[model samples]
Target: MKPITMLALACLALSGCKNEEPAASVPSVELRGRLEVDQEKTSARQAQGIEGEYFRRVLTVDGSDMTLDAFINHYCPADTRDETCQKALRIKKIDDVSGATRFLPQGL
Candidate 1:
């Protein structure tokens, strides 16, 4: 057998014996924020003939304004429209939220 071939086989064997242990899973943080209706945007949507409620949730995190929608998209899987629904987040909790609780907006 060639030296290069032997070296390659030895390296492969060593890699196989390396740690197979699973990495520790980090807990997700769930944030709680005020679910307020954005009437101005809603009105704009109506003017444009779009039907539906327009919402912008504001949450203060570490003394900064954070968009709840942004966090949800980052933490949850999106649908075809590139949007994450409440049901999806409820089904699967991911990423760091404040209270580790699922966010659900009423009548949305």
Candidate 2:
């Protein structure tokens, strides 16, 4: 065996035996409640014939409450040409909206 090959094998063996510390755990964000849009503002924009509806919603993350603007695509459905058929075809929520607490994080 070559002297360089022996030295490389020895270095590799020593590196494998070295102790490695465990990685630090990352803090996770606990989103416990549903975030909803402000209906009053959304309706106001819809009344003004805005194709892209921009609205604000309040979300509390990591004990801090902040307002965020979200946009939704509003247009007449392809199957219908009526103006009243125009709507924002986004699935806003999946779960029940009633009887849910707001802005409360888990574990107090």
Among the numbered candidates, top lDDT falls to 1
When summed lDDT is taken over every stretch of 10 residues in candidate 2, the lowest stretch is 86-95
Off by over 4 Å in 1: 1-30, 36-40, 48-53, 75-88, 91-108
Alpha-carbon lDDT, every model: 0.52, 0.40
- Candidate 2's C-alpha lDDT? 0.40
Per-residue lDDT over 36-95 for candidate 2, one digit per residue giving the tens place of the 0 to 100 score: 555765577679875543433443545766432121112222464432222211222311
lDDT of 1 by residue, 11-62 (tens): 9999899876553222233345554567887798789998876655555645
Which residue pairs show collisions in model 2?
Answer: none
Q: How many clashing residue pairs appear in each of the predictions shown?
A: 6, 0
Error of 1 at 25 (Å): 9.9
Candidate 2 RMSD to the real structure: 15.7
